[model samples]
Target: MTSKIAVLGAGSWGSVLASVLDENGHDVRLWSYNKEQVDLFNSTHTNPHYIKDHTFSKTLVAYNDLAEAIDGAEYILFVVPTQVTRSVAKQVAEILEKNNQKVDLIHASKGIEEGTYMRLSEVLAEEIKPANRNSISVISGPSHAEDAIRKDITLVTVASRNLGDAERVQHLFMNSYFRVYTSDDVIGVEIGAALKNIIAIGAGALNGLGYKDNAKAALMTRGLAEISRLGTSFGANPLTFIGLSGVGDIIVTGTSTNSRNWRAGNELGQGKSLDEVIDNMGMVIEGIATTKAAYELSKKRGVDMPITSAIYHVLYDNADIKETINQLMTREGRSELS
Candidate 1:
């Protein structure tokens, strides 16, 4: 039941997951590109830069060198931002090649690559050699680090093409507070994980504009339609959208202040420039980049995603938020199921 796990990325979510594994009696090695962060976590057993007022498990170790962190690990978890996923995966592949070790891959990060429009799993698959990889799995849902660290009842789905691989991850992170479900719909899970951030941005913008629950409710409902539209177009199960990674993720990220994508949208709706919001947040607002990727992807796939398009224009074209909302409101009516 005990395994050596290398968690690459020392951000808020990564640290929290590493702590969870450590508490589960696993040997967890957390790697951060920033040596200071690794040193800080090792010395104080905390990551104040991201998650404050919380102490990490003492058994969890921090490493600056990727090779050292994954030296003997059986599972490698990628929790870095989407933009850096490919680069980090390349490094991981090289290390795995030199060691001639193959490990199951699990990524908690979500986003579609802007130019390639590939899902994070796809990006990892491309970078990590097939010989050095066992199975690629993704853990996604409504769970957030802020809530998970408090031992809240958090639920997520671990999905992969291989059912056995998913079950393996399910047992790895499941606990009293953290519940994990298994799914074979890797495409649906990853799409839902990546696209929900776009809807969350719209939800935050509505809140910033002083919209009521009725309006927020409408936005979320229609946003689900857009997510499902594109997801199913790419061969995802429609039922997957109603599950944890889809509607569950939307409700949590879209309505809550804890989501960086929502917070970024709130600032944007309040008349702050995208640059200002991004600079102030000092974190990766995935929806901003994801909006662009999804927009292009929807166009290429001939899928209608007005919400994603509106957010893309606002973030990239500097469109007026209020006007954009009005435009969305005035769009021609269609059947609810359409």
Candidate 2:
């Protein structure tokens, strides 16, 4: 039952997932784009930048070469940023073509490409060669890398066009602390995973502005509504939004201080500039780019995503946050169901 798995991206999430797979008795090869990171992991079994407190599983291996990490592996799990997924996929495709290898592709990143507005799975499908496509799946939910490293109980949904593919991934990662649920609704799962980050920013912003629990509660509720609307407009199952990838994700990201998007939004609400927030974060704040993509996609699809639009204005156009909140509050009242 053990499989050779190549885990790309060496970030906190990637390292933690590789660790989890190793714990599950898999042969894991962790890959990083940076040579120094690979060296650090190989020498000390620790990633000071991302997971400084914990050492990696002794059975897990690290590699700087993508081809070396992917060679002879049966699965390739992508944990890189969404914006760079296409490029990494292209490289993986080239390597697969060269070696005549095919493997299942899984991605955990959550974000939509800015201009193309393609979901992470879509980006993989477009970039990866068809011959190398075994099946593509996305594993996502409210899970964060920090808690995941601590073996905190986490539940995530795995989605694919093929039911068997989803089940295969479920068996691979399911454990006492880590649980996996299967769904065929890739559109809903990915949409929920991507859009919730934007709303989390708004939630954090509200908190930073000294808004009470009432305001945060209202923002999260309305945020879910708009998320459902946009997701359904894209042919996603409305019910899927009620699942882990949807409301479950919103609850965690929107409320937790560990969320990068929420943290960035909080800083912005405290009167810091977006650039300052991002620079201070030092990690990719996915919501910043995803907000623009969601806003543009909502308009193109004729879906009313007022919260997304408002966040987009604040982040991209330097719109005043207080004025933006007032404008949102003043919008003509509608039925709660609407």
Candidate 3:
């Protein structure tokens, strides 16, 4: 069946994913908050600000009006920054109620809400009225729009509490170049997605500090251990950490030059201030907020996430990177098998 998909937040990932869906023969309507961006996408079929020089699918449409975007769409995919997800959800809820529409919700954003510390799906549940909503699914992994645009072999997971919904998204997005896997472990997928960015910041800092490959490897390895510890505390399957949504995401976000979180961390390691990094990136770095939430959650849950705490202090408290690294290394030595 030719399904109608509405994609909210026409950023790099959102735009690219819309194009991918359209390429897979679905009718896609992309929504942008900025009227100028919507007009540009409609006129030129390109989002120069984010995915420059890449042309969009000919059948894909862009809209500035939320109502138009959601009109008759079967699935609504949100790729907005995590911080603004609630506001967007409220707006979507209003539109859905007014139009008497019930649609499946899918979010590709990765972050924990700063104050509430809620995952993206949780935020959606809180804001979107149940009667107007259907199944909720999250699509996350190591997939980057830059690489996906080039038709690279990308693997990601579609997770939901509802297995049928996960399978639906999996089938919708799956293709030769982009493979999709389904899982019922939404918490694991989300935690892995949110927390990996924090580790990537540490990894990027290591690179910025002129550390070698061994240091990066150690950071990635220990990073996963801490992520697994914290995720399991939240009722997530421990094995999910080793899956595409967990380790796969950390490796890509931690290592890729295409990763905004990594680039932000690299800048921090090279001596850029948080304000300076935010001003320069011109995009929301999910790790900054996720780091704060993860640190707070670790403390609340009594989970030992030393690396996450260190990154939180560096970003929030202006802790010295070298000093933090020394403190971590000089801490009472423990067995790696622990």
RMSD of each: 0.7, 0.9, 0.9
Which residue ranges in model 3 land beyond 4 Å of their true spot?
none
Error of 2 at 94 (Å): 0.3
Clash totals, every prediction: 0, 0, 0
Query: Candidate 2 lDDT, tens digit per residue, 193-267?
Result: 999999999999998999989999999989999999999988899999999999999999999988988999899
Q: Per-residue lDDT of 215-256 in model 1, one digit per residue for the tens?
A: 888888899999999999989999999999999999999989
lDDT of 3 by residue, 15-123 (tens): 9899889989999999999999999889988898999778887699999999999999999999999999999999999999999999999999999998888999999
| Candidate 2 deviant stretches above 4 angstroms | none
Model 2: what TM-score? 0.98
Candidate 2 global lDDT: 0.92
TM-score of 3: 0.98
